[model samples]
Target: MKYIPLRESKKEELEAWLNKSNEILAEMKLETNPKKRRAIIHRNKSHWRNDDLLNYLKKLSDGKCWYTEARFVAEYPQLEHFRPKSCARDEDWKKCHDGYWWLAFDIENYRVSKPMPNVKKGTYFPLREPAMAVCDPDVAITRESPLFLDPVNQGDAELISFNALGQPEPCPEPAVDLCEWDKRRIEFSIKRYGLDNTELCDRRKELWVAIESMISEYATNAKRATHNDCKISKGKAEQLIIQLKKYLEPSQEFTSLISACFLSNKVGKALYPKLLTQLLAA
Candidate 1:
């Protein structure tokens, strides 16, 4: 996923909602009884589960699921608590620990994900288990090395590598000395989040095939001309540039993958050097 800068909604004051969040967190922290604290916070979850917050988050991704790039309108959008607000679970929902109830009302803990992946993911926030101790749900945030990837994190953009087949691989940046933590996170997140769900992969492959074919067509046209350098005319170049830039828009699904595909190909880099600069800059 491309780095989607979260622009707070113009219709609502999120700071006001965050203030309510802080108030709830404060109460949860002070209560000694875990059951009482959970009940209190769970009771007030509606404050965090506001329409304003969901709308603001959806705005951030232009109605795309922040994780899977799924369309929010067709597939239902959920306010996925990155830190499983109720409880953390295993791959299946069978085993669960006390959820991060303290952050149940915290806006920062919220994200917009499609229902399918979110359900598959459930609360399976796997860390390097043996090395990391099981933390109390209340204190998990401090002790945990979160395996799930957050779309808001700019660094996550580099953690995944995409191919023309529309499948994801661990990014090759750290291939020589791959961090076990990162390798696990990427592998786990992809499987759990279903980033390469069959339908999603098919769409991504369509993009790759489309762009790849267009470039080949351009070459064929160039071959028909004398003194050909396997290059299109300036007019053709401008048209190609416009087409490539369309994928860079936020409205486009899987822009990070699209951008990566173009940048990885030598022909794409050479054909639209200026366009490459523009896409990367965006």
Candidate 2:
């Protein structure tokens, strides 16, 4: 997943939700009566109906489910409870499902997901503790363990990788056991959320192949031009470099290929300085 910058409008909506959640929590705490608590919960769920909020979140996330990166839209979006209500006992549930009722409106815990992924019927991948600690210090106490990835933390992406097949894989790190929790989480998320299944994987692979072909074509052109005039206009060279850099930024696979190309010094030496200057400016 790529980094998502939060907008001011979203922040305002979150604040409003939080206020409503706090009011519900207060009402729950004041009422010891069971029927009253149930009614309160129902009322709270009603107030939680913010279609605009959900739409904004889904748009911000680029229509991908937070956990599985599967597309979730108008008909498919699932509203997930950051902390499941099931976690709390009956009495505690009446008070507040999770300890941090204050965070009920917190956008950080709120994620746009699909029904299957949120249900955990396919997998139960938990966030990593260290990452959670960085994003939310209170997470460890509430979650008790880390097996899932936190979207809020930018560094969490370093732990995972996507193959040409569009399948998720663990990064080449010695510490995490790929066969155990990490692999299970990936498998579960894929199956549960229907990620990279069937057409999606095929489509992604096709796109990857197309990008590779473009890079190859560029390399060929560069080679042929080098032998002909052995010279290219400075502006033309700069334009090519800019395009390559832009394509590389959003693509992990392309970034790696660019690194390999540069490390092997495959690109013409004359073009190196110009490319370097463009990159530094970027």
Candidate 3:
């Protein structure tokens, strides 16, 4: 997962959807009964399904799932609410309270996701402090600390690390040592987001093998160029660096993992000190 920058300019195309969202919010505010408010939300559920809005959200993640960094192939992608729309579930999957109905149509709350994780997430929006959970639309949601790691937040994305085995885990040495709470949050995100599903793990493993092979070949070429002044070996090493740099592109699938692998590998580290200075800066 990587940080997905929001494009507020795209909101221009959502005027009609926003207006309809306001109408629903108003009705929800007037309804005193929880059941009736849920009914109101169900009736207007289609308002958030705007095609333009979806396209904009997809662009933020380069057509990949924000949480898992999986590009859609066989399955159709979905516009998921970072926070649930109708009902909120706790860490234990217990129904905790009414969802963030006001933000149901808020474009900022949307996340582009794959079908499996989207369905698995369902209404679950666990918080660090349940008591601080916002029940009313008027309350600032910023007060509530969510346990889920948001792909849109660079810090949250950095909390997760992929192992050489292709399993997702908490970063072993984060910039700062993570507290117990933060560690739990990262662990929860890995399991809940389906980051370790079989297919994804296998694909990541394949990538790791490929990267390892290239790094080894680069090391062999670099040594020959340095000791024997071999021009051909120098050219080959330069080309290998170029190929490795492509893996770091933001639009590349599993780029965060690719970056982690390159930065941590012993052979990669040796190359980075000299030839990979500019690539590391990127």
Question: Largest TM-score belongs to which candidate?
Answer: 3
Clash pairs detected, candidate 3: none
Top-down TM-score ranking? 3, 1, 2
Q: Please give each candidate's TM-score.
A: 0.82, 0.62, 0.90
Report, for all candidates in order, the number of backbone clashes: 2, 5, 0
- Please, what are the lDDT tens digits per residue for candidate 1 over residues 1-282? 556665333535677877787888888888978789878976886776688787777888888888877677765578877777666765445444566666677666777888877788877765555246344544546466677777767676568878889888877554356687787778888988898799888988888888877766555554544346434464575576577667666788887677667667676656655665687787
Q: Lowest summed-lDDT stretch of 10 residues in model 1? A: 130-139
lDDT of 3 by residue, 78-120 (tens): 8888899788899889999778877776777888889878888
Q: Which stretches in model 2 have alpha-carbon errors above 4 Å?
A: 3-10, 31-39, 70-76, 87-106, 119-143, 173-191, 230-282
* Model 3 RMSD in angstroms: 2.6
Off by over 4 Å in 1: 4-12, 90-97, 129-143, 174-176, 219-234, 271-273, 279-282
Query: By TM-score, is 1 or 3 better?
Result: 3
